[model samples]
Target: MSLVRVLVLEPSELDPVGPLGDWLRDAGAELEIVAPAEGPLPPLGDYDAVVCLGGEMSASDDAVHPWFADVRKLLAEAVSARKPVLGICLGAQLLALATGGQVRAGTRGPEVGPLLVAKRDVAAQDPLFADLPFTPDVMQFHSDEIHVLPPSAELLASSPRYPNQAFRVGACAYALQFHIETTPHVVARWCENSPESAAAARPGDVDDGRLRSVHEDIAETWKPFAERFVRLAARYAGSLPGDPPPPRSLPLV
Candidate 1:
């Protein structure tokens, strides 16, 4: 089978695709990273899946980063096309906004550090989330929260502080408020950039040893999740033009 073609949208230098790229590539995907500021993006039809990375900017900051509008449009288009799409952090916020949800500065302050998010009951029926643990470890660094999910969006996971930690729009488009692509080094850099945000976490949460340990835990749980996503994308890519639609509750194999 041909490798799944994935378009990876990176909105900021700080939040590149990072480990998620490695995970997807190892799972048999060919990724094309695009920085909307650098040049025009390739047509979405060329790829079978999309992964929008996190960014420091707010999702609705079109005045400052006009490319956010373009990114949201692309996300909407991909969802409409039934292509697999994964949006992280600001990308998730953009997805919510593009699909009629609301995003604003988080009312509870920045949710940073290594944390656990509980899977919603409905997640048991989701293709990507079905097999995950009840509470999965993730890295949180966002100051903006997706306050309202898109109409008809399925809530997949939540934390005590953020109710919209993860959600699904339509069948295959997933949005995650937290970060699974971060490494210890990446977290250290983020801490350096936003000490105030880092300070929001429990003491020692941003420590080098703690970051590394949490990342190891995150990798153990989320790497398979990433692989499952690639498999979903690959199946979508391999389907014949006239094949019947696959069931929404795809097998975890």
Candidate 2:
């Protein structure tokens, strides 16, 4: 079998580290994690699949982070090349932003725990999510969300607060608002430092217990999703084409 090359963009303390590295290694995908601003953004053409991990900074924070333009261009090029791309949290928001979808501060508020996710019809039938837990407890730690789905994009999953949790840009590209790649320990480490969650429990803030519970769910769900992503990577590493945009449905609960 040919090797699958993956590009992972990381810009936060909680971004995938040892655990996820092991996860992807076990899944047979060779990954190169790029911390864009910290280091240098590598050429996008060499990668078979591009994976953008979540970060504390919003993808829309162009004024503060000049590096965002490079990140945006990489995502756009990935889509243009029809390469399988995966985005999580800010990364997912980046995917939306790169593809003409609108992203804004989650007006519904911060989603910080196990959420009741509502899935679109396509999400239920998605091959990438065939093993996903139903209404499964998924980890959420963002204060922003995608407000619009780009043209021909498939709305996969959503929650009460954020209408778009998971979406597909094309046949091989996908974006998810939840952190399926995170582990309980990983979140604890970050939450332990995060001033907001570290100080004290604000009215509706998620405490350590709630955070751990959902993170466990995220770890469990990661295996399947990782497998699916790797599968897409392997396929795309071998071929590239603009596949037809699958039909989509906006399930308004």
Give the best candidate by lDDT: 1
How many clashing residue pairs, candidate 2? 0
TM-scores of all predicted structures: 0.94, 0.85
Candidate 2: C-alpha RMSD after superposition? 5.1
lDDT of 1 by residue, 201-243 (tens): 8999999999989999999999999999988887777643443
Please state the error at residue 251 of candidate 2 in Å: 27
Query: Could you tell me the lDDT of residue 205 within candidate 1?
Result: 93
The residue ranges of model 1 lying beyond 4 angstroms of the native Cα positions read 239-253
Backbone clash pairs in model 1 (N, Cα, C under 3 Å; residues 3+ apart or in different chains), count: 0
- Compose the digit string of candidate 2's lDDT tens values, residues 141-220: 78787998877899888787778899998666799897777765666666666656333334433566776666666667
* Per-candidate local distance difference test: 0.89, 0.75
Error of 1 at 102 (Å): 0.6
